[model samples]
Target: MHSFFVWYRVNRDEGDADMVIRGMMARLACRSGVGGRLIRKRDEPGLWMEIYADVADPARFEPLLRQAVDEFDVEMFIDGTRRTECFLAGDAIPAICA
Candidate 1:
């Protein structure tokens, strides 16, 4: 399995950040081979993150993500510094390293 982590700050001044996030979640939930959870940083009001687990190849999954973002117009609600990181579970965890 592959895992992807995305982090960003909401542009709350533009709209209801929570509502925009929920809309994004709803959109992504309909995609196959992808499952994710949305989270908020307790110490940072506008900061958020999403963790996705997918069995599909990253090549396949990345485009799906891009499409979803475009379809849902996510960029309008997020800050410019949004970031994403990806990993293969077995390769990324120190405890699993030989």
Candidate 2:
């Protein structure tokens, strides 16, 4: 199995990361052929990221990726990366991706 991670940031408050974002994000994942997505909140400071994973082609996730920030505005800024060169080599997805 292969996977990728999408990293981004949002305020650590509710106003910016609202319910609409959650619903939309859930919907996007459903549409993308992904089983689901995992959302992580930083313990120390301002950071929000979602890791979308599955066996589907990454290209199919592009629309959801673009809509995440462009339309929903759930994040302040998104710094994304594809785990092509280096990736975790174990069963712990959260430990490696987060």
Candidate 3:
């Protein structure tokens, strides 16, 4: 499986952020092989992170990303910079044994 991470900051005072994110998560929950979680940083109030795990297939994933951007009006909520990173399980290293 591959993992996708998205980090961004939003203006919490704006009412749209929470609704958009919750709607996106609900949609993701119904899709097969796709799962994710939304997290907010405790230290950095507006900073948020989304982590997703599923089979690696850009063709399938890209559309979802685009849809979210369009439907959620993400441009309005997202702060200065938004970053996304994808990682493959094989690229990771386990802790070394003593």
Best by TM-score: 1
1 versus 2: better TM-score goes to: 1
- TM-score, every prediction: 0.77, 0.56, 0.76
lDDT of 1 by residue, 11-62 (tens): 7663566676667666776774577888888988688898887645788777
Off-target runs (Cα >4 Å) in candidate 2 are 15-18, 75-98
Clashes of each: 0, 0, 0
**Residue 52 lDDT (model 1):** 88
For candidate 3, give the lDDT: 0.75
lDDT of 3 by residue, 47-76 (tens): 988888775785688677767667666767
Please provide, for model 2 over 1-98, each residue's C-alpha lDDT reduced to its tens digit, 9 standing for 90 to 100. 44666555544565545465566567776677665454666583334445555545666566566675467664443334322221333575566565
Clashing pairs in 1: none
Pull out the clashing pairs in model 3.
none
**Model 1 spans > 4 angstroms off:** 13-15, 91-98
Cα lDDT for residue 7, model 3?
Answer: 88
For candidate 3, the clash count comes to 0
- How accurate locally, in lDDT, is each candidate? 0.77, 0.53, 0.75
